[model samples]
Target: MAQRSRVRCGHGRLVALAVMAGSLVMTGAPGASAKGAAGVRPPGDGDTPMCRLTAGPFQRQVEKDLGLPQDGEQSEQDCAAIRKLQNTYGISPADGYAGLVSHRAAVVDWATRHKATLTGCAGRSRRLVCVDQTHQLLWVQQDRKIVFGPVPARTGMPGHRTRNGSHRIYRRVEKFWSSLYDAAMPFSQFFDRGQALHASYRPIFEDPGSHGCVNLRYEDARRLWSMLHVGDGVTVWGTREGA
Candidate 1:
């Protein structure tokens, strides 16, 4: 087991949170609460509501709130576009929602605004463009191009393998703890449950070790952290076969 530490997000652009005032006002609908209510669930709580909200209005509202592109309706194409955007920036969508949901909207908005692209190659900052345990690699992009290289990395062991799906750089800390080893260590924010990308002292990369953290070079981790901000995207591509 290894010690885990928090990754510092540092200072950067301020991510704007959407105004929930309008949406918070309940219409007294079936699932909605009355006016001035605080804990009201929306129209679709446990059971999926009868009226499926169109992706068009939702997308429009998201765009208007986050100042991103209006990608038409929430068709398959729109979903794919959103997924692509999420992958490029490493954020996830809701289980059944079309576009980026409330928590992930800020990240998607930032990636869209910065015009960051998803590439098969590597980044110029010596960042790890990790898709999964087997497909992880060190990469750099120069002149707007990607370059990749094979580098050692440590991933979560069998039962505690790094989680799959899209994520974002939410809150970051300077020091973190490894629940598996109960030691202090360094880490970055990619998941909520104490998972991170950090530095490893041993040859853990050659073998599947670590509770749920992604072990990388100290400098590499810092560089990647600096390049990222809260709400930046993070897409973990699962096992190598699919990545």
Candidate 2:
């Protein structure tokens, strides 16, 4: 007999779960979604299959740098959160142990590229905002090293593209409301024209793109708020193809 797990959604709908022969089985509401289950994201149909994904490289990298396992036996709830982070951060969404491995691998890649770009920050001023549009990554660098980040970022979507080029932080506001969409922008640092770099809660990984500003995760935005100031160097480089 399989142990049954039951869950209730935000709207009071019920979900029944079971594990049979080492596989997850959900025999509940026909439209059961991850959003309905404990506020975690559902698993994604990943670019790479689980069988093809490997843990060796990511584990070794994490051990060397962060000194942690890529991931060990994660619970359903934990798996949900892990999946959420991977997708929300634009990392690979391989399932189970493989997904965890891919996430770590992504972190290693970002760190390496971000470090290399720090060379350009050499001999710069007090702060440097390096935006690599090709990678959709943003990191704060200072004096030949990274101060914070290599966080996931997204520029404007296809119709309204983010302008590329070196610019300066002309203005900063902790909280700004956009009349264009009535959206909330936090830790906004305007550099080029009306386009700004601010905290974005929008789900870019889900295919919802931005208008023109560089959208960053909330925590990443908060970090920038504490680190950046008006008149800091903001260099936007590369181009997001078909973005």
Candidate 3:
């Protein structure tokens, strides 16, 4: 039987499931905690949380991406816009800082805007998972129309670099227990050999990367689990930086 998904979201933007904070248990796959995607807990309190008043490193780039004054300076308007984007993508602290994660998410969003042309990955006529290692991002498209992602992803690194090529999702395990790593892999969808797409409880941008799987944020992985299934076309290309 096909797994019933709790949420059905659209492309460019998807609903992020609540995740429990400080619950990560690493099991060797750079994976997430056992809380899974169903961990329902709201972040912070109040309608407007306290914003980061300082300018982030990616301040200028994010300003341009959000169509704000490209002054490379943080402003009230800039914080609000950046925070909105952060909230939409489940980035924590959502304080409207143009930090690396926020900037990366913005870049991914910008890539999918206005139905922009995505250069790599095939299967235009059918469900296709596009992995662009150059950008450290992933997105799903069909009929040349993006259905999901352009989300931040951490692929294999260095010696364990993920192999690039066309493949298919051969298996899916909602909560896979990895004895090899003594860890838990949530929303695991195997596409090639031991490599699968799964949620990593730790921050997706953390260093050293995954063993071979495409590591997504827990919220992003949950959304991806809902969007993808066994047999979907998977195309991975480009070299993961430093790999």
Q: What is the lDDT of candidate 1?
A: 0.41
Model 2 — which ten-residue stretch has the worst lDDT? 7-16
User: Which ranges in model 3 have alpha carbons more than 4 Å from their true place?
Assistant: 1-50, 123-125, 203-208, 217-230, 239-243
Residue by residue across 1-243, what tens digits does model 1's lDDT show? Answer: 333433221111111011122222211112221122223224344652222123422455544434545653433333334444434433322221233232134333443344345444332233334434443433333454443223334556566667765555566654655443544555555554556666554422223345566666565666666655566444454442110
**Cα lDDT listed for each candidate:** 0.41, 0.53, 0.68
Candidate 3: residue 77 Cα off by (Å):
2.3
Between candidates 2 and 3, name the one with more favorable lDDT.
Answer: 3
For model 1, the run of ten residues with the poorest summed lDDT: 9-18
Off by over 4 Å in 2: 1-109, 112-124, 241-243
**TM-scores for all candidates?**
0.40, 0.56, 0.66
Q: Using TM-score as the measure, which candidate wins?
A: 3
